[model samples]
Target: MADAQATGPILQLQGVQTHIGPYHILHGVSFEVPRGGVTMLLGRNGAGKTTTLRTIMGLWRASAGTVTFDGTDITRHSTPAIAQAGIAYVPENMSVFSDLTVAENMRLAARTGAIDERRLDWVFRMFPALKTFWHQRAGVLSGGQKQMLSVARAIIEPRQLLIVDEPTKGLAPAIIQNMIHVFRELKQTEVSILLVEQNFHMAKSVGDTVAVMDDGRTVHTGAMAALAEDDTLQQKLLGLSLAAHQ
Candidate 1:
């Protein structure tokens, strides 16, 4: 295997295709997630953004093409194997164990079978509410708090790549701002992130680069600043102006 650190992209997809049963979802999707920054996956509804994330995570295997992670081909790897390779995924649903306490839910996410105190402390610093409700059941938490717990679980240990889908979908404005802050801080740790978000403001604020998907294929890829600055390009790819979303 090549040295991952020497490679520029932590994750790369090339001509990736996925089919959910008989329905073809991802048709030759391709993109790259740079080594140490947030990469936003942006598109309109039914654009296969979530499908792309799932394919990368091995929840849905790629029927064709390749998903290379830090120089490894992971397209055919199992979900657990993909995770073991140091990629953590937080799906759009924020799938926390509703019956479990915050602590229990977190404990389950730790692959080492026990949560490291130092890393737990880091998670607490990013989300104080999780610390406050350590013993509370996950189901009883508010929407935004649940989202935080989901993210905290993914980062309870070190990971090379973090893939999150639609994190700001229904979050309140204040909570969205908090999430933006958390993402910014996480990037400082040199963890590469592939984030799928509909909130253009949050995407623009935290994203260093972006890949825009449309009709199950990647149509555009470039610097996030470039997309944000060009209203005409934003309209062409995303079908909406970033300024209007602000």
Candidate 2:
């Protein structure tokens, strides 16, 4: 893993606390996604993993602490403001415009006047399947294709950070493998990813660092290699024993 302090983190969430109505979800969550690494947010269901991503995107406001992106405090920014600030979010639902074609979806994601040809080429390169389905309506696409499209659209703008929520959630084994390959290819780029994933194998395959959340708080933070070795830590935090994988 890279030294977070030396290269500087593209996104940093410090002591963030969030609540929905009277239900407190996140408590003092703090972590950093360095300039060019995938930081996996790992936890069981209802551990505030998705909420944390929402908070970063300003979909859910944090009652305390700050969300810093590219060294700027964007804790209180709006969703549009956060997006304009170079942070992209792909929610659990893979929010693609169902009525639109794949190309049209990409066009809508282009904030700038002219579309980014370089980013378009890169996205197509990463997922050639997308290029083949460019004219097809997003609603008819497969689960994996929609996920790819969602991620591709998010990266169309020059984003410094990407918050992906449960990307592998409901994907088939083969689709999950392909998605993992896509994430690996994305990691080779300059974008920093904050991946909220319950798929431990997928997370382990692509993540540079992993943070385990339990009961609305971060309970463990370490390199992927270290976490892969500690069966006790895996079971305690994620309720899954990685002993079989070992």
Candidate 3:
């Protein structure tokens, strides 16, 4: 096995294909998420972005190809096994236990049995709303607050990689800005991030590298700065200018 910590992609997908029942979702999708930076997965709707993420998590098993994480092949691993291998996934739906209190939710995410006070404090600092409603039930929280809780859960415990989908969707401009700042700070940590986002402002703000999918396969892969600087490349790959999206 290669040493992911030394130099190389923390996560790599090669010729990956997935089938959801009878429907083929991903067709030879390939990309890489560098060891400790944010990688943006960009594509229009129904281009299989979400399916690719689900496939990585083992929620939807791939019919063919490989998903290598931290130098081990996780393509056939169960969801629990994959998670135990140090990957945390936050889906687009902002999945949170509605019946559980914020504190309880965080406690469950701790995974090692007890929540670390310092880590909890760190999470609180990143998202103060969770601290403000520590004992409050998640069901009663507003959408934006729920989104924060979802992210807080993913980061509460240490992991090698963090995967999030459309985290800024439906969030207010201020909330989105806060999320951008949080992601920026997260880059300083050891965890690598693979983010799927349609909001180019957030993507361009924090993405060190980017991969654009089209019809279930990655069509373009390059530095985010390169994509940001070239309007023609952005238009050619994404069908719109990243600058115009903001």
TM-scores, one per candidate: 0.97, 0.93, 0.97
Clashing pairs in 2: none
- Residue 104, candidate 1: alpha-carbon lDDT: 97
The C-alpha stretches of model 1 lying farther than 4 A from their native spots are 1-5
Q: Which is better, 2 or 3, measured by TM-score?
A: 3
Scanning candidate 1 in windows of ten residues, the lowest lDDT window is 1-10
Each candidate: what lDDT?
0.94, 0.86, 0.93
Alpha-carbon runs more than 4 Å astray in model 2: 1-6, 243-246
Across 70-120, the per-residue lDDT of candidate 2 in tens digits comes to: 877999999999988888899999999999999999998887546778777
> Candidate 3 — which pairs collide?
none
Candidate achieving the largest lDDT = 1
In angstroms, the error of model 1 at 168 is 1.1
Instruction: Give the candidate order by descending lDDT.
Output: 1, 3, 2
For residue 213, model 3's alpha carbon misses the true position, in angstroms, by 0.1
Once model 2 is optimally superposed onto the true structure by TM-score, how far is the C-alpha of residue 178 displaced, in angstroms?
A: 1.4
lDDT of 1 by residue, 4-99 (tens): 446668999999999999999999998999999999999999999999999999989899999999888898999999999999999999989999
